[model samples]
Target: MSTVFWAIVVLGALIFVHELGHFLVARMMGVRVLVFSLGFGPRIAGWSRGAGETEYRLSLIPLGGYVKMLGENEEEDEEKDQSGHPVVVADAPDSFANQGVWSRIAIVFAGPAFNFLFALMVLVMAFMLGVGELLPVVGSVSRGMPAEQAGLRVGDRVVAINEQPVTRWEVLSQTIKRSEGVPLRFTVERPEGPILLTIQPRVQEMTNIFGETVRTWLVGIGPGSGTEFVTYGFFSALVKGVEHAWRMTDMIVTGVWKIITRSIPADQIGGPLMIAEMAGKTAEQGASSMLFFMALISINLGILNLLPIPVLDGGHLLFFLIEAVKGSPLSEQVRLQANRAGMFLLIVLMAWAMKNDLTRIFSDG
Candidate 1:
C-alpha cells in the first residue's frame, strides 16, 4: 500500500511539474490555456478559476496529464463546453496555433527543461541534508579474484585508479567497468603506508535483478558494511547538484546509444512496476534516499523526453527546427502521420517495458 501511494505521489508530482512548464510558458506567450488537468480520461473532480477561463481538473487516470490551450487542434476554431455548446475560443492573437514556431518550440521544450531543473533542486536538497554513501574501503576480497592476486588486502583503502582519484565506491566501480580488461594502477592506503598495485579486471557475466545477463568487468572486492553521510555547504551543494544532473544526463544518453547499437539488451528497460518497487525500497531507507531516487528518476524523465522520437518534446523541437530552416511548417498530413507513428512506437515500447517488469517479478517470486 505504501509503495502504491509513493509511486502515485512521485509520478503525479513529476507529471505535474512537467505539465506546469508548458502551462506557464503558454500563458506567458499570450496563448490562452483552456484546461489544466492533472490526469487523463474522464474528469473525477474539478473547479474552474479565472472566471471559467481555465478548468482545473483531477482526472480518473493517473498515468499522465496535459495542458489544453486555445486552438491547440489547428483544425478547431472553437471548443465545446460540458453541455456540448460551442464556445468561441480566443482570437488568433492569443491562440497557440497563431504563435511563431519558436514560441511553440519553447513551450514544448519547457516540459523537459522543468524536469531537469526539478532534478537539480532535489539533488541539491539531498546533498545539503547529507546522503549516505559507500567509501572506497575494501571489506572483503575473493580469494581467486584479481584483487587478491594483486596482493590487495582486506583493510586496504583504494585512493585512486589509473592516476584518477576516487573517493566514493560509485566512482571506483565506474572506473573499473570502463577499464574493460586492461590493467589499471590502483593506489591504496594500507596501515603501514601507501602502495601501488596493478590489477586487470576480469570480464564476467552477471545476472542483474531483472534476470538479464550482462557482461561487466570485476575485481571481486566489496565495500565495507557501514555508509558515511556526506554533506556539503550551499555553494558546493549547488555545484555538485548540477554536476550530478549533467553526469546522469550523459550516462542516460550513452545508455540509450548502447541500446540502439545493440550493445545493451532492450529487455533491460524497466517500467512503472520497477519504479514502484524502487520507490518503496528507497522510502524505507529514509527521506534522503527517497529524494535521491526521485532526482534520478527526474533526470531520466528529462533525458527520455528529449530523445528525437516523434510524439515527444524532442520531436516537436525537430519539427520547429525544420520549420525554421525551410521557412514554413511541415504539411499537416505529414505531421499527423509522424505523430501517429510516434504514438505507435511509444505504445510498443511501453508494452515491452511492462513485459520485462512482469518477467522480473515472476522470476524473483
Candidate 2:
C-alpha cells in the first residue's frame, strides 16, 4: 500500500511538473490553454476561475498527464467558413497553431526541459541533505575468484587501479567492470604498509537492475562497511547538482543508444510496477535515498520524452523543425498518420514493458 502511494505521489508530482512547463510556456506565448490536467482519461476533480479560463484538474490515470491548448488539435480541412476557403481554427490570434514555429518549438521543448530542471533541484537538495557513499575497502573477496587468486584479501583498501586513483567504491567498481578482462594493477593500503597487486578480471554473468542477464567484467570484491556522509553547501551543491545531472544525462543517452543497437537486451525495459517497487524500497531506506531515486527517475523522464518519436514532446519538436525547414506545417493527413503510428508504437512498447515487469515479479515470487 505504501509502495503504491509513494509511486503515485512521485509520478503525480513529476507529471504535474512536466505539464506545468507546457501550460506556462503556452500562456507566455499568448496561447489559450483550455485544460491543465494532472492525469489522462476522465476528470476526477477540477476547478476554474471562470469562463475562458484554464480548467485545472486531476484525472483518473496517474500514470501520465497533459496540458491542452486551444487549436492544439484543430482540423483545418474539416471546417470551412461561408467562402470556399478552409476555416483555419489554428490561425486564431491566441491559438497555439497561430504561434511562430520557434515559439511552438519552445512551448513543446519546455515539458522535457522542466523535467531536467526538477531533477537538478531535487539532486541539489539531496546533496545538501548529505549522501552516504562506500569507501574502496574490500569487505569480502569471493573464493576462487580473480581477487582471491591475485592475493587480494579482506580489509584491503584499494587506493588505485591501473594508476588511476580511486577514493570511492563506485569508481573502483566501474573501473573494474570496464576493464574488459585486462590486467589491472591495484595499489592497496593496509595498517602496516601499502602493497601493489596485479589482478586480472574475468567475465561474469550478472543480473542487472533491470533484471537482464549481462556479461560484465568483475574482480569479485565487495565494499566494506566503511561509509562516509558528504554534505555540500548551497553553492557547492548547485555546482555538483549540475555536474551530476549532466553525467546522468550522458549515461542515459548512451544507455538508450545501447538499447537501440541491441547492446542491451530489450527485455530489460521496465514499466510502472518496477518504478513502484524501487520507489518503495528507496523510501524505506531514507528520505535522501528517496530523493535520489526521484531525481534519477525525473532525469529519465526528461531524456525519454526527448526521443523523436511522434506523440512525444520530441515528436512535436521534430514536426516544428520540419515546418521551419519547409516553411509550412505538415499536411494534416501526414501528421495524422504519423501520430496514429506513434500511438500504436507506444501502446506496443507499454505492453512489452508491462510484460517484463510481470515476468520479473513472478520470477521473484
For each candidate in turn, the TM-score is 0.83, 0.83
| Per-residue lDDT of candidate 2, residues 204-285 (tens digit) | 9998654468899998998899999989899999998998889888878878887888888888788999999999999998
Model 2: residues >4 Å from true position, as ranges? 75-88, 142-152, 158-166, 171-189, 193-220
Q: Which candidate ranks first by lDDT, i.e. highest?
A: 2
lDDT of each: 0.88, 0.90
Instruction: Quote model 1's TM-score.
Output: 0.83
User: Over the full model, what C-alpha lDDT does candidate 1 score relative to the true structure?
Assistant: 0.88
**Candidate 1 collision pairs:** none
**Maximum-TM-score candidate:** 2
